[model samples]
Target: MARNRKSVARLLIKAPVYLVAAWLLGFGFFVLTLPKAIPDGMTPKSDGIIVLTGGAGRLEAGLKLLEAKVADRMLISGVNPVVEPHELSALTGAEEALFTCCVDLDRAAPNTAGNATESNLWTQTHGYQTLVLVTADYHMPRSLILFRRAMPNATIFAYPVKGEWPMLYLANEYNKYVFTLIGEAFKPAPGDAGKQAKSATGTL
Candidate 1:
């Protein structure tokens, strides 16, 4: 019994260390795979485009893609409620007509997860099956995870924006991605289609 107790204690102490090491290795791999530069002349068409706010140049990139006819519809997820479409066009230098007819502003999402939820609903509402997802490169991994969970049937293409981000920001995003992965692992399988549709439409 004494030998068993000692072995148990050793295992308990070593478990956390192993877990942390595994997590760090996974995080490093994720960082290494992130896009370092924006792709040029590689525009692939999709059913629509969804841009998650928070990163610089993301909106402009989305708009440019739309202008290039990459997709006919676009959603700027997580927009501030106060910002008008014309104001966004002015900021991005996109023509006002482009946004007036084809763009939607989603003010409901307040974070990456919320952006996924809101974009999923918007895609469903518009009958979109494929989407071009625009966000910062460091954020794309977590964003893709949540978006895939929220809309498993949709085809999502990442269009990561390259920018100068501080190390602290990258580290924080990495932690969030790790936490999200762990959380999703233990989550129960989603319910039927009706229930899922209702859940996606509701606020996160």
Candidate 2:
């Protein structure tokens, strides 16, 4: 009985250590696999482009892609409610006509997950089968995971923006990515809100 108790205690103590080791390994792998840059002179055609806010160069890149005719439409997700389309046009140096005709502003999303939700809705509304996702390099993994979960049928291409990120930012993002992965694994899939909305609208 004493030997069995000792064995149980040993297992209990080592269990957390083993778990920590596994988590560290996973994080390391994630860091190594993180996207460094979008390829130069490579324009991937998609049904639309979705740019998540909170990083420099993303909106401009998406706008350039749109101007290059890589996609016919673009959704700037997570826009501040105060900002107008004209303001974005001025900031991006994209023509006002382009913004008026093909660019959309989404002010509903407040975070990355919310960005996915808003993008999914917009994609369904626009009937976008493929999307070029623009965000920071550090944010791409988690963004991709949530976006994929939210829009399983859509083909997503990552266009990560390379930047000088602080160590703290990288660490926080890495932790969040791991936690999201674990949470997603256990969470049950809810019915597609976008599809339901599309069905009701009877449009794209």
Candidate 3:
């Protein structure tokens, strides 16, 4: 009886390690599957930078890239209609005329999926060949899934904005990726996300 109890205790002690190892292995595989991160200082040659709203630093990152001439245009998706161009200009520290000339504020996208929808429309209309997508790092995985579905032929580049509390952000993103993967099973294939929030720009 004592021997059996000791065996059970050992198994219990090892079980956690086994589970952790499995999780790490799974995470590694997921990370490996992702496209390699864009190298630092190599300015992206894209038609425009698509900035998905919501994250703290994403807008700033997009603005910085635009200021640096990484792209000629900028699309700030999921913008509040109530917020005028001047307001956004003040917020982004860019001139209102510059925003009007180079920026597009889209209110159609209220979530990540909506962002994808609006983004696809904007990109398609503008005849953009390459798109530099800016979003929070944790949100990038899900963004890729939705964007791929939305614009399969477009050369989409991810410009992941670093976030505070990266560890927590990563944990949240991993869980979101899992949820999105599972959700994909029920969703229709790419280019058919009409009413659903399946677009890349949709909420996380």
lDDT of each: 0.90, 0.90, 0.82
Off by over 4 Å in 3: 1-40, 166-170, 185-204
Candidate 1: tens digits of C-alpha lDDT, residues 87-152: 998999888999999999999999998999999899999899999999999999899999999998
Best by lDDT: 1
Which digits, one per residue and each the tens of the lDDT, describe model 2 over residues 58-135?
A: 998888888888899999999999999889989988889999999899999999999999999999998889999999
lDDT of 3 by residue, 1-204 (tens): 999999999999999999888878877776556544456567567898899988788888888788788899999999888888888778878777878788888888877878888899999999987999998766888997888778888998898876463566666667778887888788787656654655655766
Residue 173 Cα positional deviation in candidate 3, in Å, after optimal superposition:
3.3
What is the alpha-carbon lDDT of model 2 when measured against the actual structure?
0.90
Deviation in Å, model 3, residue 109 alpha carbon: 1.2
Off by over 4 Å in 1: 1-23, 36-38, 190-204
Candidate 1 yields a Cα-based lDDT of: 0.90
lDDT of 3 at 158: 91
lDDT of 3: 0.82
Cα error, candidate 3, residue 23 (Å): 6.1
